[model samples]
Target chain A: MPAAATEAPTLDSLRRLTRAFRVEILRMIEAAGSGHPGGSLSAIDFLTVLYFRDYLNVDPKNPSDPNRDRFILSKGHCVPALYCVLAHKGFLPVEELRTLRKFGSRLQGHPDRRRLPLIEANTGSLGQGLSIALGLALSAKLDRAPWQVFCMTGDGEIQEGQIWEAAMAAPKFKLGNLTWIVDYNQVQQEGLTKDQMDLAPLKDKLAAFNWHTQEIDGHDLDAIDRALAAARKVTDRPKAIILRTIKGKGVSFMELQTAWHGKAPNKEQADKAVAEIEGGRR
Target chain B: MASATTGATRDAFGEKLAELGAAEPRLVVLDADLGGSTRTTAFMKKFPERRFELGIAEQNMIGAAAGLALGGKIPVATSFACFLTGRLETIRVCVAYNRTNVKLVGTHAGIGIGDDGPSQMALEDVAAMRALPGMTVLQPADRAETRQAVEWMVRHDGPVYLRLTRQNVPEIHEPGYRFEFGKLDPLWPKDPEAEPDLPSLAFAPPNGKPRRQAAILATGGVVSNALEAAKDLQSRGFLARVFNVHTLHPIDAEGVVRAARASQRLVTVEDHNLAGGLGSAVAEALAAAGQATPLVRLGLSDFAESGTTEELYAKYGLSASHIVEAALRNLA
Candidate 1:
């Protein structure tokens, strides 16, 4: 239990950390018996890089620091991934990850700010985190603070009209301090996103709404780092980084499987999933 | 009851918001593309930077309002009461649970928004806002009360719902009226006589317009009408009085108890529906307090007709004539 963050990890080590994050996410969801695994596994690399790498100006001891960079999980059902990242970063105890979605635990089924002070807002309903992020970003501008606000949206969740509403509003306010990263996992509760309701040519749609749009491989930690850094310097309009992601990213059985979206793997299945995640980095 | 001047609570809200904006730097306003109708344009025009236009996105506007409040600003989010409460889930989580200093101003309340019909009406807003824990519900009776409520709400430091009206209602209180939270303002019969002799009670002439047998509790633009109805009943030798129930939630239970004790029957009138607004609040209070006064909730029982406000009120039995008729029926 180190009080300070460890030394900056190299690309190879970051890849290892992301693999560890995926394993922990699988273990946590398996332990909880009810959790989001597909989205959590898919977004682990981006989250791992943001929190563990040389980015994200957050102090674990001072989660409520007014000037701290803000991250909102708009796809809040994937909080298992966030909980893993927070715990690994000392924002939470790693031992408590198994208590997710349990009775009388801080880790609820969805993101609850009251339950966890580090959470920016309660965002289970989807498509709402971007607007709140814009709000926090706008506040930073108003106060002349240098903090940034980042909101992660699930690909399927963008179908909500409020997402477009925020997409349209960010440019109008010229919210340079805000960045919405889309976890384009291509899988949702019902089925494949393309089959449910197509969000194809998303880059054009985001560009039309006047955002600085970028597309990248979500699993590439270096690409994520570069994209996030580049997006931060745009300072003219709000940025949207479209991270092309596989639904179940790491585990061999779970990878690219939509059925794994919300269901927890059984004990043997979880063991295999963790073994595959841990072995993949080898 | 015809006053020299009439005012829309929304119009006064805009002016007071602008006034407050000039003084309070952290006071921000968000409009969901209804700036013109919601009267947030006044504040927007004055403080463009401070007033954010969310462009027909009530959910986003509400979320942003909560965020801004979290960032140390008083954010007032405005829209048609229907649209604002339509995003009740967002409000339920971001504003109510987070306990941010976000003042949600829902104008065009009830069926009084005229031709726009039920889609634009906020008949169910009171029920929704009141359902949330730690949410303060305040509906102003007139221009004075509206301004006072807005000013007080900006400084109150919590989640509040300030319900305003689209129609022009006559000024009920004096210019210097102060807005009190969770307290009913005495508006009719000045002061009700305490415990009149029930034994010596004389019935009015059975031939003329019957007697008033209840105290009318009302809110919003209907307050003046309830007062007029009470005065009209007074002319017919009925001892009915009216109380302007501005704060619907945390409703002054003492006022309901007093009103119930003063009359044999208690009538509550609002432009809202028959269930879950002023009526439900009053009924809950009286039942909990064990007041056995017969209650009559006067509001639209079914969907409202798409007509002028006056015509709708007449049809829904929320007009002054309906109040008089109900009083007569109750007394009979």
Candidate 2:
């Protein structure tokens, strides 16, 4: 059985665990030969706090429990981080993380629910996860179920018009059971997100859309935990947490570097990054 | 002969869907600002709590429907065919790839939608939906067939794309008509059990002149036109058998091959683009079956102009006369 929030592990332990997960994220991506490492590293802390710290109501054994909270990685290119966290959460074997992106492996390059039934929906295509999350939240409301729906999207991914479409509908439907976390890393594949498409005043935009908005330093475990706790208290409208984060967060050489956005780290680079993440662990 | 009673397939869909909502509590409806036009207003009026008005955002609607399906609710997302399939990327990922139990209802299909013109008409929806693996594509010919297919869509698991007509299509199916998935319902001759005898493949019957025979495969609103075409062909002393092909993706291939063997030629008619709709499906079936039946595809060759349904059908070569001409063209 998973621990409740009251019996959750200390924030210090979560910090150490998340720092170690940075290595797992790199290891799998390095083994797979191609993945979006920058976004994965930027988003790992929130996923760890959500899964390991009892914010999400999923169990490894009863992953398909109807009443369990649904979490969807709408920015599915960053699934390496999700795979690592799911492994630690006992959803799958840790050894299977190495099989990610390989032919016939359950861990597809993106979140494919067909291949991994635990995934709430298939969501590699950008801007789609929020609407799907809206659907699940709507279903919960219709059934009067206690289940909640949470979706995570990259800062760059909100550029797709469908994101706004979902953003517009969730609030209109009064989907208080839903929460959307934006990993506002401010960087994308080609260049910085601002240079490509500016999402400045993102919190204001979401607030105007009627979402209960909050902005926090995404890498801080305490802030992530608190923001999620506060989001749960919101029962009249959808919650939007603009997680201001650094792309390629943990690795010094990769931080804020557009080159690390998609490329898999080489053997030397992977070793150096892993050493850096492990050294940062206190 | 076309029945005296005529009804829009969308009306049948909305009526059946609203009825299904009462019986199946798990059923939910989503509309992208086209509830009135798509006739989902009927379902929405009765089951307001169960209906979601997503407002002009088809991409979000498709994704939300997938999510609802994943959450164990049978979601029927309704929109104009052009607008609905316009968001194919979301449908490709959330619905098709995930195999979510979403019933996508695309109304206002083809030029039959009339003065709304090419923008509103779904000329490429069937092609887009058919290309996705495991996605069931259906285009019901009449009100009864639409009701039956709508019922089947809810009961069946996985994704289904139902193309419905905005214009009132003539009732071609009899009152006792039952919809069979992936099976062709022969409309002309009234009996499919008896093989349609028109002309021989090898030796002609020892009569005056061997009249050319054709098996007409038609889908959606054009089935009535094809039926009328068959009647006209009979009057002109040429025999043409018509098949109501409601199921477009997992089409009745064996039935198509059987028609190919029995008739001297095959003609497919639809209210969609000729490249990837009913024509392409029949062509693939015949090719795979190694049948040498010549086929003439009649559909929109280009984007249609704003006009009445009858004017567009007549001008765009989808009228009864056009179908009769297509069937007897090269055989003469």
Candidate 3:
């Protein structure tokens, strides 16, 4: 039997994981000279807690093992954070992180399942991951497997009509084994999410769709851990966690800035960001 | 009034699927509340535990199918081809992109779906399925072939898109004839030695002389039409060879190139868009082989019109006469 998840992820652990993820992601993007780092940095804590402490049922060596939990990164642009977490968990060599977005690298700008294992689906086009996760969850229910499927979506990507279609579907199907985490960083490539398209009353909207809903600070590992625990307790419906986070959480100048969504940090910007993350870790 | 002999392809698909469920325990069925229309009712009845009835949600149905494949289940998802293709982008991206072993049974493919009109006819499904990487596309010639195709798909690995017709077709292939994926079956002989020269008045080439002629490449219900045209053309002193191209993607490029080289005139017929169906695939193969034969492609031009299957076939110039005319034109 798998260990029961608890509110075990600590703030200190989260801070260290976040800094490590940020530094590695910067290095990856810098090596490749391209990739979306803002969203990856913003969603680091949630991904860290999920992979290292919650949801993921995986052994890095035996990734194709059937009983392991499935994780589908629907918002594929944030692959750097996902790659960092997967490497940290030993899914691949940590050295591969520096090859991000480079030609012939397994770590492409978007996630490709053929190149990586434990990646349930290849997702790049937004708003499709949840549906894939729902499929895996439904299969688990049918097979009577003890595996769960975790899907992470972006706030800007929620604007796609397909996401709502999946949102309404999970509850209707009573897929309690499915959990969806929305990175509500309030910024898109164009501008702030609210400025682009208001998705206010987000909690009620999910509730209306029949999802068991919880809202949390995305960067707060403890809050994310608790929300996931609460979600697991529900067996009647699918769960959705609305994770509130800054677009660029740790870096001062990049925080909440739309322009940083996909831009690689230059030498000076990289130095400043690295110093801040190191300072925070200290 | 529905004729006993004139059953929909969806009905044959369902009947064959029930047999598959009994044969393979891992075989599961999923429907988007269209069990009656898509003809998965028999499978649902026999294997209720293995069946999922997704109420009017094609997107969810696709997702659930992919999920089931991940759990070691061979799921056959049934829906109208139109709804299946238009609504289930996730299925194409997730299930197909991941190369999961799932079979998508798209019923009511092409304009053979009479009276329901353009919205129901899925002329673009072949194009959509072929566009996905690592996807195998199958369009069976008739009921027996549909069953054979389903069995072949179950044993085969990776994603498969099975295009089923809503119109009944005559059984052309004899019993025990093998159905191989990605290999074109030559229904008519091109070489004299390979042709069955029976003592009792064999169907020989016209003028009692073996001559180089065009190869008629087609699939689905149109194979019979193409065969009929080939017979008529043979009577008119033309040795038209007929090839039943069951698989669309990973097409029989070698066979097509060989036929194109020998014949130097290729005519493709199908009950779908002329742009991306069998004709387009054959054209692509010919181009790759640097063999540009005079090819006359016949299929639906654009949007389909509402009518009976026969009327629509004739209206869209996809009948035996149209094929015969195209073959003649290609020869000219």
Candidate 4:
């Protein structure tokens, strides 16, 4: 729609935006004194590309635009990342990012559609958001609207039986307008995903179920952009992009660690994580 | 075998939906591959452009319905009652919890879904729908009422759950019987011969206004049984007022309080669990209203056992005889 916002976003621009999203997310989680920063930081690049360069048809000021692309954060624990992107996109004032999880603030622990715009559904319970995304996609097809549905899930959350149920059904319905990106960080709330539950050959499993599958380095902004473009080209079946990523890619202390799954950083840890992200920005 | 009326609530739902689709361009239908059973095939045939078949997936059907509602479409999603609620966490979190105006039509509800056994019967649907904060739960008695319920649900400005039956029931209401959500319709007392119209000797209201007494609050298929029980109670000189409390959630609190105050004795009958159903809603209303009417709550005790609709109704004390016995005991 507006000629795809020309001047192809450069790797430097992508990294800078991702860094900004990570920093803002870390600051918000630190302000709340309790949030899942590891996943948020890990998912920043994927979310950044989707919102800025891919599927979403959003105008930050007009969050309720009837034909806007719909995004569902199935891994709702990583709401800090979404809040950062929404704030950066001007859906909410950038100053409001500090209000994350505060008393009487729109930013709850998970996305609440009633309280926030551009949040299509309420998703805190794992394994349920994909079903909703499928519904939204089906709705778009029925209404003959030209909008796509994007849902991001956690690798650990794949253990849920309902996720497979939804996965199995999406292809059967031929939902080409729907895309599911799994943040395959290989770490769960308890520990390593392999130690907890093995979801290996994830791509093969999705392909077997009739999904157009792609595995990419989640932190590679260019690879994410390419994969999203490739996803749009496949117009007959649903698409699944398995993003290989580190649990906390930018912050060295939290990287690939299970303890940061849902813990907030104290003042000391916050200062180090912020400095790490800000230094990466340069 | 008794020739059953060709009653599959899905048929009424589909026909009414197709009508709504023609009248309102925004009305769309979504099905989870049970189109034939859920009776959405008619709408699918007539409005193929507007019907979405999600192919045996209930979760996706619910999520897609919510998205459609967000995109300025009034989507009605249909599935068997068991799958509709068993796979209901999506509807709870995505649709109702988000306050999306999606209408969930669940067919094959209660023991009436005979022969298919317990897995197909949605005995606990009322509990599941009523648990949501602002959802409107409707259980219509017959085909005509089902049509009326669907129309009301479309006009209603929030999430709704319409419990549909698989068996045909005798038509009770006339063509233009006015229907209102959150209001009870009294089927009996059509004439002086009706039980609720009997002239009793005394026990009138102390303020000289006629005191409404001996009321039965029933919903869904139980309304028919309650009517039968009222007739028998009248023949035995026990006049009882029967109230069809159709809308389970946001229950008729004022009507319930008025009945409790007038009768000083109330009984609730439903084809569901005693907890969080019509009985529980009435009990909560009476409790909040601070009324001390003796209440007899009738429903399945816990888990249900396999049986025909009639056998299960008798076994679970949901038949006309059981209602009459409960009323008699309350009077005693």
Candidate 5:
């Protein structure tokens, strides 16, 4: 049986893993010649903490086990983060990350579960993943199963009407086993999310929906760990963590830059990004 | 005259779902706030634990239903046909492409819905549902057939869309009706077993000119009109055959080919848009079979207006008289 949240992958090591994920994501996106690196960098810390720190009950072998916890990448534009983390955890071949965005790549521009069975759904048409995860959560609740479902969505992507649709539903179903982590990087593809469309008082909006809401620094591994632990104790309402993170978090030049939301870095920029993460400088 | 004998297909869908709920443990129903309209609430009332009422959110409901299917539950998601089919992107990516075992029930299909106007009428639902890969589209002719198809849908393994009507229709089948996927039900002569091609003799019209034999292929509530038109044409000394096509996607191409061989012309009638629906499917199938038989497509060529079902049918050329007129005009 895989460890569940209280086991291996200590906090120190998870911090190290997050840095490595940042490097891998940048290099992979650069190699693919196209992909969203800003969102990938912004969301990697929470994904690393969730997947590596024994928080999720997953088996690289036998992924379809009925009792396994489900993970849905609602923010699918940043799948490079997920690909790198899954590879490091041995769910996929590490060499496959470079082939992303290529023709016939299992890793398409968006998630295609048929190509990669470990993927729960074909997402990236933003605001769809939460609903898919809600189904898994609702099913587990119906069967009285112990598995919980985790989903991650981008801050700007939540502006889609369907996100609110899924948001309003999960709490009504009293899906306590469901947790949605909002990667509130504050920057969308066009510009800063606040300028594009203000999502101020986002926590209150989610709270009013009857969700157990929390605001945390998304880049902090310790805070992510604590928030996830707290969410597990929620009994009657779904959990929503508004994780405030910086776009292109680990790279100084790319940070808070809207242009980096989708573009792949050149080899020169890729070298600088990898060096920054390696040198332990934000 | 009790309504049960001529009840709506959606009513049959709801009633059969309740019966299937008792028989199938894995069966679950989900609705997008229009359970009352879609007729899924009957099962919801009986098996409340298995029912999920996702209020006013069709996309989420569909996506969730896909997840439920993946999680080993046979989920039936329901809404007004237009609203349910309007969420094509979610269904396309999540359910159809995933090949999840989801039964999508779209009630209040086509202009038969009456007065609710084009927004509610799913005139193009079959067009959208048929466009998806692995999505089986079925629209029953009446109560018995709807019940049988609903029961079969629970047992079928992949994605299926069951289209139903709000308006009550006359029960067309007998008590022991069985729905076979990809098979067409012959209705006009009341002969499901008859080869229907017994009219090989070249018949002359009233003016004494020989013309080709013709057949009407139809589905849903408009089928009764097709039956009437077939009778009228036969009485007028023209060979008329009618087939009620329940399964629209994996349509009985064999039956269509046989009918094409038997008749020189085929008129496909439906209460939907001319594109991507029953007529389009039949045309594609016949063309793909390398058959050059002429065809007259009968259906809504434009958006519908608020009116009675009969009024819409007449104005849109879906009435029995229109079918007869189309047969007289084409079938060469």
Candidate 6:
């Protein structure tokens, strides 16, 4: 296992890693025959910065460490992004990423902790991650443990009422150790999140729920790093970082294309996507 | 004779949980705004730091309970049975599929939570919970059993769904009776010493002209009614034996087969829906064991109305007289 990055990687290096991961994400989905590629691509950059930038206190060797920082992908259909980051961190074999969504594979279609212990909780059904995250943060606060919980949710996923229920709770418990990152990729499985269900006034609603809020361009590695660092200093209230991202972030043909939200790229399209991602096309 | 001493199972759960909370530091309690009705206030009062009030949001409460369990805390999440199981998707993934050690306490089960009507009653909770893999479903019959079951639920490592009653239930077990998982609690012919050397199948007394015998399997809020039904049947020159089915998921299949062999017929009564409660479990057990024993199921066929507990029980065919009729069907 690689040692924890004592120093943050350069933004350029982080971008390079993100681009490589974007290609892996597309290839794995194409290999699986069925998966959500757009959201995975949109969330990969944030996940890359979060995992590689050393903002999360985790040990790949001891994935079950009680005090290790917890991460939950609430919008679980995009688990290809999480799997890519975890593989790179040595939590699981990088080669196993190809076996995703297959029979008897640890890389379940969704993040299943039972099959893979590195995942903090099983989440595929939407709007459940924040509550689980709040519970973890609340537990840590109860024990005065020096650990933080980070959860990532999609813009369309917050349509569930349970998200607000959890949003209301984290502030009530004063869970300052928890950080929620919303991958506001704007697009959803059906269409744009707004056309499906308007999450307009998203930041104001969250702020009214008493969360410390931050808004940033999700593709900016520096912005993600800064928001994570700011979340750590807040020891009295939970923090929510809203990452404005583009669905199908890197692949030009798939960018903002609702069809790319869940449909896997074909062999021809997969080859083109790899070329585009490698060529640094946005 | 069944003991006249009675107490609500939710109260027993609360008393036992508070005691367990004191003993187990890792134990945490979460409530969905029904702490008073579910009787978890006792736990909250004693262990203020350990108790979490998640308001009327049962889904979030369930998710948080799973999170706490993952964080190595024994979380007892409580709400009315209907509201708790209404979030079946969350439980299906977070608690059951995840195989997290979360204890789900669903009080006010079935029509027994009278006056609140069908909306508040969890008539299908057992069915929903039973469908989930690796979920332990328990519906203790009385105070003694509930206390023991609560203790066992905490000590056991896995997901558990404990269905409790809002109404008081008569004591069915004798003093010092132990609660074992996946086993039937024999209630009738109370004195074991008096029935020494009883035949393994088809017990008969001297000068008995093949006395008509039937076994009554009951669970949760209806076990006492079943005992009463048994007594009523015996007074009419028929022999009836009663067994309490506390664990509903990993049901006592062996005991069910034994009871089927020992009696001429079998009758199952529960406060839950007839489709997926004790009766369905017994029928499945009998079918799996290749027993063609005649069986009768007595429970709600539809949603119950708002009324007193006794009136609702009678209306829903869960009363003792109704149980006696069910057992007597096609048997003189």
A90-176: candidate 2 lDDT, tens digit per residue: 999999999989999999999887788888888888888998999999999999999889999999999999999999999999999
Q: What's the ranking of the predictions by lDDT, best on top? A: 2, 6, 5, 1, 3, 4
Native-referenced DockQ of model 1: 0.63
Superposed Cα deviation of residue A89, candidate 3 (Å): 2.4
Candidate 5 residue lDDT tens string, A1-282? 343445577889888878888889998899999899999999999888888876788888877888988889988899989888888889999999888989988988888888998887778888888888999898999999999899999999888888898999998899999999999998998999999989889999999989999999998888988888788788788999999999999999999999999999999999998998999975
lDDT of each: 0.85, 0.90, 0.82, 0.82, 0.87, 0.89
- What TM-score number comes out for model 3? 0.92
DockQ of each: 0.63, 0.89, 0.63, 0.62, 0.72, 0.81
lDDT of 1 at A197: 90
Q: On a 0 to 1 DockQ scale, where is model 6?
A: 0.81
lDDT by residue (A77-127, candidate 1, tens digit) is: 999999998999999899999899899999999988888888888889877
B135-196: candidate 4 lDDT, tens digit per residue: 88898877777888899999888899999877766666666777787787766666535333
Itemize residue pairs with steric clashes in candidate 6.
none
- Better candidate number, 3 or 6, judged by DockQ: 6
CA lDDT, candidate 4, residue B164: 83
Instruction: Give lDDT tens digits, candidate 3, residues B1-332.
Output: 01124345566778888988887988988888888888988988899988888778787678767767877889888888888887647767767777888888888888888899998999888888898888999988877677788888888988998988877777777667788878888887535466442222124454675444778999887888888898888777777788988898889999898877767478999888887889999999999989877898988778977999889999899899998898888354
Model 2: which docking level applies?
A: high
Ranking by DockQ: 2, 6, 5, 1, 3, 4
Model 4, stretches more than 4 Å misplaced? Answer: A2-8, B1-10, B191-212, B330-332
Candidate 2 differs from the real structure by a C-alpha RMSD in angstroms, to one decimal, of 1.8
- Which run of 10 residues does model 6 chain B get worst, by summed lDDT? B194-203
Candidate 5 local lDDT, B1-332, one digit each (tens): 11236679999899999989998988999988899888887898899999998988899999899888888899999999899989999998778887889999999999998899988889888999998999999999888889889988899999999999999888777666677888888766666354446435355566787645787899999888887898788777676788899999888988898888777678989989999899888888888999877889999877889999989898888999988988878443
| Cα misplacement distance, residue B100 of candidate 6 (Å) | 1.1
Best-to-worst ranking by TM-score: 2, 6, 5, 1, 4, 3
Mind listing the fnat for each candidate?
Answer: 0.67, 0.89, 0.65, 0.70, 0.71, 0.74
Best by DockQ: 2
